[model samples]
Target: MRGDTSNYRDLFLGDVPMMDARAPIEFRKGAFPHTVNLPLMTDSERQKVGTCYTQQGEAAAIALGHRLVSGQVKAERLAAWADFARAHPDGYLYCFRGGLRSQIVQTWLREEAGIAYPRVIGGYKALRGFLLDTLDRALAECGFVVLGGMTGTGKTDVLAQLAHGLDLEGHAHHRGSSFGKRVTGQPAQIDFENGLAVDILKKRHAGHAHFVVEDEGQAIGACSVPVGLHQGMQRYPLVWLEDSFENRVRRILRDYVVNLGAEFVAEHGHEQGQLLFAQRLRQSLDKIQKRLGGLRHQQLAAIMDAALAEQARGGGVEGHRAWIEALLTSYYDPMYRHQRESKAGRIVFSGDEAAVLEYLRRASTMARRPDPGTSA
Candidate 1:
């Protein structure tokens, strides 16, 4: 934190824990991958300091912060920092900008607990900037291939098997569909972007070419893709995988109903988990009700209820296919068809899953080979 502000490797290159000295709300909004929030000031105290800074000045804010966080309160926070430092001796502390808050934490740890550690030099902002720049570079320099398909075509599956694949949906903890929300909450925007950059950099450094990505909207759940990367996807060579409607129905059932339902049960317990899964399905259908139309919506809802009833009785989710049929035939397929019409010109390859995989494998090999004329 003192000498260099550019070495971001210490935080991201390995499994080093970082002590975030920002307030709780700030940390919840967006933070680094491994950062543990251990603030110098509580949210209320920070708010008070912010008010003082606005009303009086920096000097007044500093005085108010010092006054508010003293005696037992100060000792408790310092003790927390000391405990974290003792646990992770190689760890560093960071604030929003490596400014006063971080310096105070660093100074306290050194003087009180005798743990002198460097904080992130430019802090969260700098590290984030580094990742953003990394994404920018990858978009500019790396060849990109966009994998696209109808909703249940398992484009994600095809992407996962390729050496050049970049699983954006997996990174975002989303399937890029209406019912794609995971059991756990999605990562913050910063964490999402950071993970994307790290993945891209790893693949790039390994001399992988044509970063293969799945079709996605600009936003995946709560997070938005970077402009450069999104645009790159739009313009990249497109490979669309096609599958039978029955095959897609089976895949959707396996993914959304069976697998996800089991995961919810594993995480949330039986009764509550069953209710949650049923609720999520109903909600997803409800979300696009207008698109699904009144009669179809009502029909789908009835089928979903029946499916839930069957599932609640400790039976297989084969009944979900009726609703899935109504969904794909009525909702998802139509929407995908419209989008496909628009991007039809961009598609360079279109086939079943097996053909797509073979194409990607061959393409990856071709892209990675050096030209004989240029080779040393």
Candidate 2:
């Protein structure tokens, strides 16, 4: 049997498999990327045990937990765990605090199944704390550049080309706007932060001490940027990306209308997918109604609805350009212009896509070059 581990760095770096022995509710609330939830007790059982502990103390809780999970129930759980152990001999098991639940699983595996699997030394809490610390350290020590542009300038496309780019919106499964919601839901807040931290950790390990991240607000849909990262972004050097008004309209049309509709259809099939996609577009416009004001909101929504209808009838996507251009000119452009003006002092480079990409790549290359004048 392998010993329990507290080597959080190694675990993340190696992408080790993990069995979460916490309740399903706890796992749903927050969990690592590759970890699977194989609960030691169901949510109901956990609730009863928690109540027993609160009312009668540890011993009563312990007794009640055992009684609740005996006979066939116990055997079934044991089989599941044994199967996991046999399948992932390199993985570790964990509970919330690496306490009672994990210890029980470890013990049962040893005694009943003749297998001794290791548990994470401090379990979920410790690993989560480690990720938080990792993010904080990265913020404190690393160099960052924030990419800023008007809507539909393709900031994500630029980031995709850079080795040191951090895709914050991608991590959050959002596009960082009122209309940024995807066909699928965003990750849990904890999951978003964990994924971001892991990405930063992996990049830092690969000798990237500098990164480029898109300029975004504190929250992206339901996911919030960690406090330190958000604060650092406020001060980072700004690189402005630009494109023609016509090109911007086409980009937004492809991303939000055409591509988004296709995603929905692919996930839900043709009929229901088209219905939901149309609904989502209308809902997105409605969300900004207060900000856009009544008459203007009505005007934009009307254009959008008409566009969606035309596309639905197989009349082609050219109709979406009218609404997208109007939205960009009336709504998004004004707000972004103000933001750019406010951050004028921090704007180190301003260019179209290819120029911005070249500048960033050159900057990253220069930053990583060793100083031959200094001793190793």
On lDDT, the leading prediction is 2
The digit string of per-residue lDDT tens for model 2 on 272-369 reads 99999999999999999999999999999899889888988984889888888888889999999999999999999999999999999998877663
RMSD of 1: 3.7
TM-score of 1: 0.91
Q: Which model scores highest in TM-score?
A: 2
Instruction: Give candidate 2's whole-model lDDT.
Output: 0.91
RMSD of each: 3.7, 3.1
Model 1 per-residue lDDT tens digits across residues 1-376: 3332356754565646889999998888778777799999889999999999999999999999999999999999999999998898778888988889999998998898887877888887887787777777767666888898998999888888887898988889987888898778888887888888767655665567567898888999988987888877778888899999999999999999999888889999988888888888889889878877899889989999999898888777989999999889878888889988899899999999999999988888777733211110
Give the TM-score (vs. native) of candidate 2: 0.95
How many clashes would you count in candidate 1?
Answer: 0
Q: lDDT of each prediction vs. the true structure? A: 0.84, 0.91
